[model samples]
Target: MSKQQPVLFSIGWNACINCGACVAICPQEAGFVSPFDTIAVDRPCDIACLLCESICPVDTITHVPVEQPAVSVVTVDR
Candidate 1:
């Protein structure tokens, strides 16, 4: 069975200088730069393209694995 990996992106608000590099480079327009100078990821990403991650000048655009729900195993007590 093949498992597809899903990624969750985060922008380091403190480190982000509002350069708009990521926002401009993302073809999907997934990266947004608010008028208040905040950066955010507005939607789920397929991660097929990493343009935003590659174009972040401050290296603030990053992704971490989304945690999978825990599976419970049933065991019989003898």
Candidate 2:
């Protein structure tokens, strides 16, 4: 069986309202404030937790569902 990759933390910068909710709620301390951008993920989320996704009131943060590859089998006809 093909394995489906787990979803990870993500954010939509365009939709971000500059709210500090994400920065305040993340336990991993992955989020931070930026001078140019309102907030940024300073580093990759090593734990891959969904805390950032749930805390965003504006729904700017989200997770991308992994796409599973198709399986094929070969058959011989006699």
Candidate 3:
């Protein structure tokens, strides 16, 4: 069976620096830098694919497992 895609959310989104790293690293072409210079994701993406999540330098974006309720799982670099 196909794995479910993850839903991405920006936590404390005001902290985003509008760096295009998310867009640049997204192999699924799911994320983009908005005209207002903010990070945005419009397309669906696979949860198993961590390309964007791992590449985000600021750790502003997060994803919830498809099986779980949509919640913000904050990713931080320790």
Q: Please give the distance, in angstroms, between residue 44's alpha carbon in candidate 2 and its true position after superposition.
A: 1.4
TM-score for each candidate, following the candidate numbering: 0.56, 0.50, 0.52
Whole-model lDDT values for every prediction: 0.57, 0.54, 0.53
The model with the greatest lDDT is 1
State the lDDT of candidate 1 residue by residue for 1-78, as single tens digits. 114343557788888887777657655444344553434454444432566777777787777664441224333338
Pull out the clashing pairs in model 1: none
Top TM-score: which candidate number? Answer: 1
lDDT of 3 by residue, 1-78 (tens): 124555554534676776767667655433344554444444334444666567777777766554432335534337
lDDT of 2 by residue, 1-78 (tens): 113343444567788887777767655433344553434444334334566677788888776553321224323337
Order the candidate numbers by TM-score, best to worst: 1, 3, 2
lDDT (Cα) of model 2: 0.54
The superposed Cα distance between candidate 3 and the true structure at residue 51, in angstroms, equals 1.9
> How does model 3 score by TM-score?
0.52
Q: Which stretches of candidate 1 lie over 4 Å from their true place?
A: 1-4, 29-42, 67-78
Candidate 2 local lDDT, residue 71: 22
